[model samples]
Target: MNIRFDLRQVRAFLAVASTLHFKQAAETLCITQPALSRLIKGLEESIGAELFTRTTRQVELTVAGRLFLGECQQAITHLERATHLAQQAASGDIGHLSIAYNDFSINGVLPSILDTFKEKYPDISVDLVYMPSHTQHKALLDHEIDVGFLIGPLDMAGIQTFRAALERIVVILPRRHHLADRQQLYIEDLKDEKFILGTENGWREFRQYIFNICIKAGFTPQVVQEASTSSGIFGLVAANMGVSLYSDCINRFQRDDIAVVPLDHDDYSVETIAAWSMSYTTPSFRLFRELLESRLGGES
Candidate 1:
C-alpha cells in the first residue's frame, strides 16, 4: 500500500510536535491556525492514525506520534545534510580530481603546486597518475583524466595547454667519466659518446626533442641502450652504461653516482605543459586550473 504524504505535512507535524501548541506552531510556520490544523489532519489521515490528543487546556502526542517524531527528525536532518553537500560540490569545495603527470613535471614543479592546492582546498581529493606526454594527449581528448602535466609544444584540436616549466636540456654522465668534471659541455661533445636514452613508449616526444637538438649540434647520438622511465635511464647512466640528455629537473634528486652537466647551447630547452580537454570540465578541475594559473601569474 502507498501512504501518500508531502514535505509540507512532515514540517507541519514537526512544528506542532515541537511546540505542543497549535496557535504557536501555526505562527512559527507563518500560516493561519486553521490551515495548520488542516495540514495535521491530512497527515494523520494519510498515516491512518490519530497523532495527537487535543483538549481546550493542552495538546499531547499519542504513542504513534512519539515514534514518528523521532523518525521525522532523522529524515529532516539527512535531507539538510544532502542539501549542504550538493551546494559544496557545486562550488568546487568538495570533490575528486584526477591528475596525470610525467617525469619533468613530477620531479620539478607539480608537487609544489599540488601541495599548495591541497592546503587551500583540503576537501578536494586528488589522484595522481604517471603517464607519458603522447599518452596524456589521447587521455585528455578521451576525457580519461582531468589534467595532465607533460612535455610541451602541444598543439591539438579540442585541447588547451599551459606551459608550466621551461627547463634547459642537460647531460647526465657517470661520476667517473672524463667530461663529468667540466663546468659545462656543448651538445657536439656527446656526438661520439654512447648514449642511454628513453624508449619510444613513454619518451616519444622527448626523444624527438633530443634528436632535433643533436641534429642541430652537427651529430646524432649513438644509442647503446634504452630505458622506459626516468629512474631507469638515470640508473643506466649512473652504472656507466652510457650518458643521456635530459631536462635540468633531474637536479631535484640527490644522486651521487651521476653528474648533471649543463649544455652550452642556449636555444634548446624542454617545456613541461599542463593540458586539459575543452570538452570535459568539472568544478573541481576548474578550481585546480585556477590555482595553477594564479601560481603561474596568469600565464597560459
Candidate 2:
C-alpha cells in the first residue's frame, strides 16, 4: 500500500508517542485534543497498525509504535537538516562558484577580494581558474564561469563589467640595462630595445595593448623572446633577454635582477575589470556580486 501520511500526521504521532498522554500531546501540537486524536487515528490507519494501547489511567506504545517512534524521530531530524541546508543555499550562504582570473589580476586586488568573500561566506566554495583575458571573455559569454578578473573595458552584449584596477604602464628591464638607471622611461625610448613578451595565445589582449602603445610611440617593439607566463617573462628579462612594457603591478613582486621604472606617458594604462554574465548568476555569485558592488561603491 502507498504510504499516504503527511507531516502533520507524523508530527502528531511523534508528540503523542513522546508524551504518552493524549492531553499533553494535543497541547504540544497546539491543537484541540479531538483534532490531535484525528491526526493520530489517520496516521495509524494509514500505516496499518495500532500505535498505542490506551488505558483509562495511562497510554502506552504498542510494539509497532515503539519501532515507528525511533525511525520517525530520525526521519524528522534528517528532514530538518535538509530544510536548513536549503535555506542556507537560498540565502547565498552555501554554494559553489567558478571564478576565472588572469595573471595581472591574481597578483593584484583579486586575492584580497576573494579572501574577504571566503571569510564572509565560509561555506561557499570558490574554485579559482587561470584564464587569459580573451579566453575569459568567451567563458563569461558561454556561462562557463561565474566571474572573471581580467584586462578591462570588456564591452559585450550580455556581459556586465566594472573596472577593478587601473595600473599605469611601466617598463621591466634587466638591472644592468643602460636605461634602468633612469627614474622613469618613455615607451619611445624602448623602440630600439629588444623585448621579451608573453606569447599571443595566453597574452593576446595584453600584447595588443602593448603593441598599440608602441605603435603610438612611432615604432614597433622588437620582440626577442616570448614567454607563456609572467614568471617566465620575468626570468627571461632577468637573463637580459629583453626589456618589456608591463603594468605597474610588477611592483608587487620582489625581483633583485629586474628594475621596474614608470613609463612617462599618461595616456597608457593597464585596466583590469571584473566581468560576469547576468544570465548565469547563482545564489553564491549574487552574494559575491553584492560584495563587489559595495566595494566599488565605497571606492567611488
Candidate 3:
C-alpha cells in the first residue's frame, strides 16, 4: 500500500490495456513478457485493484483499467507537449546554430547565405566551423553540428538534406602550364600530369571523382601532394607544385599564378547540399533554410 506508482508502470499498463494482449504489449514496449507481467502485477498491487482478466488466448481490461488507461493517455500527451514547448523555449528563434561548412562554401556561397539569413533573423547566432565533407557528415550524425553545408548525396539515416547549388569543377593550374592556355580542358587532357589533390579519404566522393575521371582517361594520376584545405591546394598549385581541380567558387582566391580552366564533362559538376537531423530541426533551423533558399534563388 505504501509503494508509489511510477510512470513506467502506467506506460506498461496503458500498452497492455490498449492492445488487450500481454504478449503483444510486451512486444510493443520492447520488454520481455515476464517483465511486463511483473510490472502489471506490481501496478495492480499498488492500486489494490485488478486491472485485467487474462486467458490463455486473450486478455480483457477491467472497468478500472479502462478508466486508468484514459487518464494515462491524457497524462502522457500533456507531458509530451510540455517537453516540446520546453525544448522550443531553450532553442529560441534567436538561438545558436552550430554549422559545418567546407572551402567551396566558405568563399562565396556561405557569405551570401549568411548575409541574407542575418538580415532576416538578426537575433539568431551562427557558429560556423570549417571542415572537410567527410568530417562534416560525421559531425552532423553525432549531433556535434546542428547543420552542414557539403557536397551530396549523403545516404545516412535520420538525416534530411536538400540540394542548395550545382557548381562545375574547374582545373586550376600554374599560369605557365600547357593546358592553362586552353579555354576549356577535358579529363583526358590531364593524363600524365602530376596532380595536387585534397587529402584522400577526407573528401571521399571528391577524391573518388578525380580518380574515376583519370581511370576513365586511361591512367592513374601521380599525386604530387595532398592538402586538407582548398586554400592550401590552390597555394600549392600557384607555387607550381601541381595542377588541381576545384569548384568555380575557387575563383575568388584570385591568385595571379594560378589559372582556372573550365571542364567540359558533365561529371565535373558538383552539388552542394544542406543537411540536418530530422529529430533536431528547430524553427531557427527552418528560418535559416528559408534565408539560404532565398539567397540561392530557391534552388533547394
Q: Each candidate's lDDT (Cα)?
A: 0.90, 0.88, 0.82
Per-candidate TM-scores read 0.69, 0.68, 0.68
Ranking by TM-score: 1, 2, 3
Query: Which residue ranges in model 3 land beyond 4 Å of their true spot?
Result: 1-93, 297-300
Candidate 1 segments exceeding 4 Å error:
1-93
In candidate 2, what are the lDDT values of residues 1-300, reduced to their tens digit?
677999999999999888999999999888999999899899988999999999899999999999999888867865774576588679976687889999999988798889999999889988899999999987887667889999987789888887788989889999999998899887889989999999999999989888988898899999989999999999999999999978888898998999999988776798888899876677888899888888765231
Ranking by lDDT: 1, 2, 3
Q: Runs in model 2 with CA error above 4 Å?
A: 1-93, 298-300
State which candidate, 1 or 3, has the greater lDDT: 1
Q: Which residue pairs show backbone clashes in model 3?
A: none
Model 2 pairs whose backbones collide: none
TM-score of 1: 0.69
Worst 10 residues of 2 by lDDT: 291-300
Could you give candidate 3's per-residue lDDT for residues 150-202 as a string of tens digits?
88888898988887777888999999998898999988888878899888655
lDDT of 1 at 164: 89
